[model samples]
Target: MSAGANWAGSHTYSAPAFVEPTSVDELQQIVASTDHVRALGSRHSFNDLADTPGTLIGTSKLPHSVEVIDEDTIAVAPWMKYGEIASALKPLGLALHNLASLPHISVAGAIATGTHGSGDRNSNLANAVAGLTFITADGSIRELQPVDDEFDGAVVSIGALGVLTSVSLDVEPAFEVRQDLWEGLSWDALLANLDTVTAAAYSVSVFTTWVGESAGTVWLKQTVPGRVRGELFDATRAAVDLHPLPEIDASPTTQQRGVPGLWSDRLPHFRMEFTPSNGEEIQTEYLVPRVNAVAALTAVRSLADRIEPLLLISELRTMQADSLWLSGAYDTDCLNIHFTWKRMPAEVAAILPTIEELLLPLGARPHWGKWFAAGHASLKPLYPRFDDFRALALEWDPTGKFRNEYLARTLDLS
Candidate 1:
């Protein structure tokens, strides 16, 4: 019944019993036998959300099935990787709307934490769910549809309500995407032209460091119809070209080449072919209202003097509004601000409070899977449906079988 013997490098709760179920029946059996259980996927979460002292269920081995339910819908197991799903759906001429930073993260895990990508017109991955099936704490499998009131709450349940077994996603026709990577933009110019630059493409992300008031690289992914026939932006033709490759020691030619895959398939913002700078890294991401993005980035920019030497990368991304109750984009467009620290856990911890201080007025919501010193009190105000989600958690999992320290502390689920 048990698989993982130790906790997998989470911020807290280092040791826990982990289990991997091969089938839905086996998963049901485990849930029936274990009073405390939580699903684990890819172990990509920086926080202890997936960590449970009693039993951590690993869905990585769950049966992989992708069924084309209809022209607009596809059903898949929760354990499916975004890459796998994209590959399966490509032939059907369909793909997910957006993806997280990494495609390696499982489908359910990404949806559970409201993982998002860059695009003012696109929402988090969870928003694409037309329906989901979950094994309740009492070992009952229930299917949820968008029409149900609990649907919004369930999409971003964070594995508190139940163990998600399968998901039915609303898909769009597959399209080609051309990436235009640009560098050597001053912070002032980027901020001034942020709207125009972002609107220039379907998805836009700017990566920089807290070191100087300039962007290190800007990646723009523009969706094109019918095989993306022409070049979107020529790095060679840019007036102020500064390649992202040399900064990360990657081949510029390779970095600029467009890969044939779904947008979700290439979720990892960084190119795998490149060797990133070596250092002990810690990540912290927060979502602020879209209107506040400029102000928030400006505030964070002011902290360059304090955050640069100890920081590695800072990314700015956008997300459209979504109905998922706990989604970062709930009710309004969102701008994600991410920080990657270079070693110095203590220093990173120290700067986080200030980061929160600057973002609080902007109504920033911390990424559920990432490290944050803030607890329930601060988070309650950030997410309007925080207590509503807890109520649903109680109703769906009254036995508290899926409850964990993180869930109890952040979601106030007991």
Candidate 2:
């Protein structure tokens, strides 16, 4: 781990080397020649999800382009960051339905891991992907659209299926958004009117310090023509712009004060120009069915003493369900309960099991890119289509060329 670790420096890859293929043909050749390889995204992952014991084919080098094929769709290169795609879409007066909290992650990487943004009505990032073009294990190019039977299993592949080359996403006419921050929400009040709080804005996030019965802040990103409810049960609008993470500068955050701006500008919490979060933190998130969100939060907050010491902050966001097989929100609405902990890996690891013990029983599934102790054996039943997804993985990567230790340990793969 001394070299080639993840962004948080939490997990070092076992990759013997790295490759940067600038074209589709080159990516295909690299995969076809290698017996075991994995596609490396922006290295934003906190765990060994992207690590491999073989060569790592870095997708950041495989060319770059964005195509607005029609008013409803746009195709983007795998390496293009979400911010870049949003910038490209802005000029065309187009946008996607949602975006993750940070705009720095690559489109392909985020989609592969089921990354999502906050919105009671929004789906995870992969939901916008209408078509995909990937180089299969055998160097064969396969293009799949939403209509195809295989499309659902491929969206949240977790870099398992193959090296994704390009993705076609559904887009819409550009719209405006406004951000407003509120402070001091009693935990009891929020849990009681959870529905009301979530519906307060187009995209809402509740941040907690895990110290008191009160959550520290609630961020509301409202769409144009959308209502701005700055005052919740016991919370008031922030007089000044605020950062979700306490004691940090808010300049890196997207504009606040409910100033209406482009969707690309306000959907994500952090601006693309600056780094998101502290970059010194390790994240762990769980997606539980929305029905159990309150109970799940209660369970984690019950262990506040253990979390506060190693915690930077915690965020709660909602996402509408989709049919994507591997999606944490599949067939049921979800609450993305995220924790950004201090760089204390050992302590964090020790505390996760207790947290999992509570939430897993509530149907919590860990975020693929974050640090989690749960393995396939414990997590399989959560996804009704887990075995189906496994079958699809084996079908596409017959020789296990795309299999890595993370998948082996988490998917029960040999």
Candidate 3:
């Protein structure tokens, strides 16, 4: 009973059992009966974050429901995809603070892995969680709110605590956004005014291949009612829709050319109806502290020739500071340097250590859901609350019912 391969087919699940229980009772029963279990969400992870040897309990079969708790919050089933939740909120005149590059990922999976969208003012997606409910290893349902002492550690549990069932997220009045594109900005200008370029819009993504003299493209998602104009560090505004990868078709991307649309439609880089990014590619990301961003980018730029060969595209985005224990933007604002690479796992894996060697020294933290070379010893010092998070996981799941190989290797929970 194989759990099949991930979205990119980069890794296959070794779990011997895959189960999707339609009801909460069924899910609890399965969780309590199984000695080792892991809740699997949309297979968007580039690594083995969701794998286990005993049972891979999927949340997709669970009911999808959204309850408006108040004007600023909503409690939704964990199985709901960000896109589905966005569609539900749009009609009610509500919207989440931000969304990932693609909305096809499950809400629980995204929160657990500390996924995020780009914005100088917005924190990572996990920060939006106001409350959470999960089935503990003993099959007891537990709920935690922002007031809970362990809430911060539990928000980004990495599926090592329990099987999440409901997630309450902060919401706000719906708004319209317009996406604008800029191209051919020299790296000299970008690195010189990096702060100004990222702060030019509500949300921005700067794309590059690291081999070129000019930055590839800049996608600006700005709140509507006003357009972003004037000096953009001498970068020329694009007249047409464009994809991050210069050679790929732009039809799959969200509305560009400064077209204003609903926040749900413009916040994400891709439309829900179309597949996001290169389906066959792998991804890796590292969050560098705002202070070290320029130095880190310079380090990677130094290895342009090595990275250019296996790269499909690379993006740099910003995130505001957060208090969540394991979040990449925990204490300081961060600049996310992301890579969408050609599916050469062996080649890509071989080159990662070189990149990590350069970036890690400058206080870079790897994205939890993406491909990374650092393990427990290398990762421990990067997070201030790393040991505390392990303690909380142990307290919640005493028998290690939810632990998996990925968690063991990354957190040294074994």
Candidate 4:
């Protein structure tokens, strides 16, 4: 059987066998017998990160189980989506520290790729992971905890190590959040007060098209009490709910206009019940140290004429430092620049090199699951633990049973 295309239809899997094992014993048998194999999750990746020429194991059919190990930690099925986990925790008065834009993404896929949400004080989703249970190359069960020496290196292994069966995440008391939107702030004021603007809320998102004087919309999700009035550095508070893309409808978005709601409901941009879009776009993202956020934005703005035409929209978000070796925010606070482009793959691919030439010099790290042209030579210097990570992958799977074409091309791991 053939594995289908990804969520955005941008990349199709070429694997000849797609199997969904319903039990851990079956999954282990398949992995042990297959010479080359990989695990597939929610299919949210835009590239070939989860594809292999051999058997592709679909994880969704695995048993859905949740266990509250203690008051502060919860262990869940690796294939469960974030939305499902959040809903399960709410009634018990617990919640994860943050959530990515789409709750529909599977937990194992998101953390393995270093995926994150927005907030100056919030660490990436992988940071919430306290422990992991993996089905390794030999089909033997292995568990890694925070106390392990190689735990940090394994957290974001990009599926080169093994298949994850369970993920233990740290949780906190559930809280309420309110979302507010502001618009029409010029680039001048924004650049000047950028620090103050991002620090104004619990979570912040800045949207733009790179074609106008106005820096575009600022969406804030706050946990503090009371209403926010007046202007945010010359940008006026919006009177109604608005989509990130100005011309599009906001009906599919989460509750806005400063309405108080559960953190699980307001943290994610899109409503869990709705499909955010028709999967008509391609995405690219780069995370740079927060100190260079201003310089990086200025560099991209210089090529606005080139990027504006092929773009659907763009967003800027912030994340706190993390210890995970391969995480974009590793060791320092980061500012991530995201682009949602028109489905013209050729045009988008052609312009990426030019864009990377400018941003890569300013200390930018490309998001693992998104489309990026930078390879091992350009990326090796950005991460301090790059060589260590490669060694870890080799140690975990010496024969390369879990390694695929993407891993070979990007990380040069055999």
Worst 10 residues of 3 by lDDT: 225-234
Provide the TM-score for each candidate, comma-separated.
0.90, 0.98, 0.99, 0.98
How many backbone clashes can be found in candidate 2? Answer: 0
Off by over 4 Å in 1: 1-15, 225-246, 251-280
Q: Which ten residues in a row have the lowest lDDT in candidate 4?
A: 224-233
lDDT of 4 by residue, 1-414 (tens): 778899999999999899999998899999999989999989999999899879999987899988999999999998999999998997899989999987999999999999998999998999999999999999999999999999999999899899999999999999889999999878998899888888888889999998789999999899847445456988899998887776778988999998899998999999889887547999999999998999999999999999999998899999999889999998889999999998999999999999999999888999999999999889988899999999999998999999988888778887
Query: For residues 26-96, could you state the per-residue lDDT of candidate 2 as single tens digits?
Result: 88899889998898888898988887777887776667899878889888997789999898887788989
lDDT of 1 by residue, 1-414 (tens): 444322223254443577677889999998878888888876667777877768888777789999988988999998887768877887778878877655667889888999988888988888889999998988988999999978999999888878888899998887767666666567777778777666656777777885564566777676764233233222222333233323554342223444444464344554334333232467789999988888998888878889887777777888998878899889989889988766577888898999899997798899988778788888898888888998898888888888888887887776
lDDT of 1: 0.75
Task: List residue ranges in candidate 4 displaced over 4 A.
Answer: 226-230
Clashes of each: 0, 0, 0, 0
Residue 169 in candidate 1 has what lDDT?
Answer: 93
